[model samples]
Target: MSRSWVEAERAMVRRTRLRISALVALAITVLVAFVGGIAYTAMVHAQDAQVKRELRYNAQFGSPSVPPGCTWLFVLADGVIDDGLIPVPPGFPLHGDLDAARVSGQTIEREIERNGTEYLVLSQPSGAGRTVQTVFDKRYQLADRRHLLLALAVAEICGLLAAAVTGMGVGRGTVAPLAEALARQRRFVTDASHELRTPIARAYTRAQLLARRAAAAGLPVDHRAGLDKLANSIRGLGDVVDDLLLSARLNEQSAGPDGQAVDLAALAEAAVETEGERAGERRITLTVDRPAGPLVVTGVETALRRAVDELLANAVRHTPEGGRIDVRLRRDARGYVELTVADTGGGFDPVEADRLFDRFHRRPAGPDRSFGLGLALLREVVTRHGGTVEAISHPGRGARFTLRLPAADPGVVAGAGAEEVSTGFR
Candidate 1:
C-alpha cells in the first residue's frame, strides 16, 4: 500500500473514533443531567413536605416557649401577645397571618425568606378566638440540597470522561474490521487489473493485425467490415481494463511530499491536441483557452494528464458532428486551479447529472452512451488530489464539466517560467 492510502485509512479511523466518543459523551451528559434534575426536585419536595408537617404540628400543640429546635411559636388571645422570651429572628411571627387566621377562623400557611434563610410559617385558630402561629427554619435542609448538587456535578464530570474513554476503545475495535475489508477490496482490484491487462492488450493487438491482414488480402467488403468491428470491440475492452487499473492506482495516490507541481494549462492544451484529429474527423471544433502563466497544481502528473485527457475525450465522444468543444484552464479568485470542458452536444437529462460519474452507471440509450468509467476515474483522480468535479447540463443545451484543484504555491509556478507559453488550438 502507498503511504497516502495508509494515511487516508488512519485518518478515517480517527474520525470515526472521535464521532463515537462524542456521541457517548453526549448520552452520558444527558443522563447525568436528567438524573441530577430529578434527584434535586425530589429532595426539595420532600423537604417542603417535612417542613410543613413540623410547622402544622407546632401550631396546634406546641407551647410558645418550648417549641422544637429550629421552630418558634406565638399565641394571640383577646389581642394579648404571648411570644416566648427567647430571642426571635428578624421578620419572625407574621402578625398579619395571625390576625387573618383569627378573624377567618381558618388555617393559613406561607413561606418567606429572611435572615439569610428560608422560613415556613403557619397560623391557625386554636379555640375561643385564640390564634397560634409557628415558624420553621430551612437553612439545614438547604445545606443538604447544596451538598447533593455538588456531588452530582462531580459525578457528571467523571461520567463524561469515562464515557469518552470507553467510546474511543469501542470505536477502535469496531472500525478495525471495516478498515481490513476496505484494504482487502483495494488489493483485489489491483491484483485483478494487473492480471487482466496483458491478455487484453494481446487480444486487441491480434484483432488489429487480423483486420489489417484481411484488408491487405482483398477480403470481401462484409468480411473486412466485420474484422474492423471486432478490432474496435477488442480495443474498447482494452481501454476499459486500462481505466480500471488507472482508477485503482489513482485511489492510492495522494498529493503528499512526493507530488510534483504540474501545469494544468499545459495539460489541458495537450489533451485538446491529442483529441484534435478525432474531433476533426467528426467536423467538431476543438479549442482551448489558457492563462499566459502556468496554472500549477500539485499532484501525480500522469494521473492529472489522464484526467484531462478523459474530460476531452468524453466531450469529443458525446458531441455531435460540427459541434464545438471548449477547454479552459485558469486560476480562480479563490487561488485554485480550475479546468472546464464545455461541449455543444446533445446534453443529458438534468436529473442524471449527479449519477454521471458513478462507475458502470448506464447512460441513456443514445449515440452518446458510454462504458461510464472515464468520468468516474476522473472524479477519483481529482478527489485524491483534494479537488472537486461537477457537471452542469440541460437536455439539448449541451453540457459543461468543471474540475478544481488546490493551486500550488505561487513561488513554484514562478520558477517554471521556461514553460510559460500561450497555447491555442482550433
Candidate 2:
C-alpha cells in the first residue's frame, strides 16, 4: 500500500475511536447525573422529615432550660414568658407564631435563614392557653448534604475516565474488520485489472486486424461492418479495464512531496487537440481558452492528463453535430487552478447532475451512453490532489463541468507570462 493510503486508514481509525469515546463518556455522564440527582433529593427529603419530627417532640415535652443539643425552647403561659438559659442566636423564637398558636390553639411551623445557616421553628399550644416553641439548627444537615455531593462528584469523574478507556478498546475492535475489508477490496481490483489487461488488448488488436483483412479481401459490406462493430466492442471493454486499474492506482496515490508541478493550461490544450478529430467527425466545434502563462499545480502528470482528457471526451461524446464544446483553464482569484468544460448538447436533468460522477451510473438510452467511469475517476483524481469537481446542467441546455486544484507556489512559474489566449479547432 502507498504511504498516503496507510495514513488515510490510520486517520479513519483515530476518528472512529474518538467518536466512540465521546459517545460513551456522554452516556455515562448523563447516567451519573441522573442517579446523583435522585440520591441528593431523597437525602434532603429524609433530613427534613427528621428535623420536623425532632422539633415537634421538643415543643410538646422538652423543658425550656433542659432542651436537646442544638435545640432551644420557649414557653408562654398566662402572659409570662420563659426561655432557655442559653442566649438566643440572633433571630430567636417567632413571637408572632407563638401568640398566634396560643390564641388559635393550633400548631405553627416555619423555616428561617440566619447567619449563613438554616433554622426550623415550631410553635404549638401545650394546654390551658400555654404555648410552647422549639428552634432547631440545620447546619449539621447541610454539612452532611455537602459531603454526599462531593462523593457523587468524585464518582462522576471516575466513571467518565473509565468510559473513555472502555470506548477506546471497543472502537479498536470494531474498526479493525472494516479497515481490513477495504484493503482487501482495493487489492482485488488491482490484481484483477492487471490479470485482464493483456488478454483484452490482444482481443481488440485481433478484431481490428480481422476487420481490415475482411475489407482487403473484398468481403461483402455487411461482413466488414460486423467485424468493425466487433472491433469497437473489444476496444470499449479494454477502456473499461484501463479505467478500473487507474482508479485503484489513484486511490493509493496522493499529491505529496514526490509530486511534480504540472501546467494545467498545457494539459487542457493537449486534451482538446487529442479530441479534435473525433469532434470534427461529428461536425462539432471544439475550442480551448487559457492563460498564456502556465497555470501550475502539483500532482501526478499522468493522472491529471487523464482527468483533462476525460472531460474533453465526455463533451465531445454528448455534443450533437454542429454543436460547440469549449475547454477553459485559468488561475482563479483564490490562487487555485480552474478548468471548465462546457458543451452545447442535450444536457441532463438538473437532479441527476450529482449522480453523474457515481461509478457505473448511466443516463437514459442514447447513442452516447457510456460505462460512466470516466467522470468518476476524474473526480477521484482531483480530490486526491486536494481539489474539487462540480457539474452544472439543465435539460435542453448545455452542461458544464468545473475542476479546481490548488496552485503550486508562484516561485515555480515566476517568469511565466500571464495573458489571455483562445485556440479554436473546427
Q: Pick the candidate with the highest lDDT.
A: 2
Single out the weakest 10-residue window by summed lDDT for candidate 2.
Answer: 417-426
What is each predicted model's overall lDDT from 0 to 1? Answer: 0.80, 0.81
Against the true structure, what is every candidate's RMSD? 8.0, 8.2
Name the lDDT value of residue 395 in candidate 1: 73
Error of 2 at 170 (Å): 2.2
Measured on C-alpha atoms, candidate 2 has an lDDT of 0.81
| TM, every model | 0.62, 0.65
Candidate 1's TM-score reads: 0.62
lDDT by residue (tens digit), candidate 2, 197-312: 78888888889899999999999998997797777656656655665665566534343323466788986886676677789999999988887878888765667777888888
lDDT of 2 at 366: 52
- Per-residue CA lDDT of candidate 1, range 195-302, in tens? 887787777778888989999999999899778767655655555555555555554433332256688898778667667878999999999988797788876666
**Model 1 CA lDDT for position 187:** 76
